[model samples]
Target: MNSIKQTCKNVKTLVDSFLNSTTPIFCTPTDEPKDTEAWYSTWEDNYIGDFLNNSVVKAGLKKIADFYCAKQLDVLLRHSSELKASSYPQLYRIYKECCKRLGFVKMPKLYITYQIFGINALSLEVKGHKLILLSRMATIRLNEKELRFILGHELGHHQQGNLVCHTVNGLLDTFNTSSEIFGPMISDTIEVPMKRWCRQSEFNADRAGYICCGDIDAVTNLFLKLGMESVCSAYNEYKELEDAHPHLQTRFTELKKIHKTIKVNR
Candidate 1:
């Protein structure tokens, strides 16, 4: 535990140094041409590079990614319903707008599944293939701008190599079936930092969402509606390390700071 905390601290120090030296802003004018070349240098989360370079994290991710991808593709083809522009024009338009703003030349395939309860969204990558999945409940519950924020957040995951985080998560979901095999393969060294990186990836995605929608109020209202405030207040550092996402409080607070930065820069 002490070593994990120390590692986190070291990572924080490096992140702080990187942020100090770079402009951590993504709220650019959409009218300008997509600056794909400058995307990583100008707007990427500093933590992504650090975590991706970690040998243990990379090995663990590589081990599970192909298997997870095959599993997900099977589920997508067999179980999930995909959304196309011909049938879902409004939703497709919003997705296209996000892709354009993010400068994605190759659009990801989009899929949706109906759920009796809960609102959720996720993105996946298999090798170079990218995909985004949205719950029908999410589409029904969120307004257009809020929906854009959600979609953009998924896109954010793809943009920053955060896709591997999803592979880890998917592997966990199937732990009952695969645990005997995977449990031996993934060690604490790999799992701990990978989880830490998972949490950090949310910040990057939130920024992408903000960039896509350009509406801080929509972002705030959506999070509040998701009940972030009630759940986040009680969360602690230890709990945060175990969880895949940052406390809603942490995410919203960071978004608010980014909002302020956007205002000042504009």
Candidate 2:
């Protein structure tokens, strides 16, 4: 109990220090972001890099990815169907076009699952193979522009080298670390930074969606629906800090800012 408390206190201190700095302390900062989209500078610079330099954290993250990636691939093979350019030519064409427009040279293996029930998508790298899982709900509900946004967002994670998604991909496998140190490691180092990075990373991804699709309304609507923002505003608080992603309103507002900038620049 004391250890957890102390660890959280220490993390808070580091967070404060990072937030106060002009530059983040990450080892490999995105020196040149491939996507010319905007960045959430304050959040990214503060919360997105400590784990990159930590050996213990890296080991734990790798363990999670290795353990779960294969299983996820296996499960997808069983439950999800791959959308190939040969089999689904039109969809494949769209995928290719999205990659071309987004400046993503390499395409990730893409899959779509039925009855997904949620408007969601995921990007992960398994055994050096990058993959994107686009849910059926997204296909049904989101327009082509919105689809471009979703695709761009997922691909953006790849561009950002989103290491944490590798860790998150394993979450469904009942995350139990093989090493005993992992528990302490989580409490001691990984938890808070991971939370912040995951959230901050979403900003960069959203920028990708906005830039690639070039439609703020579509992007904003996707976020608004995903968070059930209307429902939340009526019943729940405007924002929930515990969420891995930012509030829908916050995301939409940020997109609006981007829209304003684009308009002014034009």
Q: Which candidate tops TM-score?
A: 1
Q: What is the lDDT of residue 216 in candidate 1?
A: 85
What tens digits encode model 1's per-residue C-alpha lDDT throughout 189-253? 34645566677678878887887878888988898877776444344856787767888778888
Provide the global lDDT of candidate 1 against the true structure: 0.68
Q: Per model, state how many residue pairs clash.
A: 0, 0
Model 2: per-residue lDDT, tens digit, 28-124? 6655535433342224553226534354444444444655567856777577878787876876787787777666656778888863558888877
- lDDT values, one for every candidate: 0.68, 0.63
Candidate 1's C-alpha runs over 4 A off are 1-51, 54-63, 115-117, 169-188, 234-237, 263-266
lDDT of 2: 0.63
Q: Give me the candidate number with maximum lDDT.
A: 1
What TM value does model 2 have?
0.69
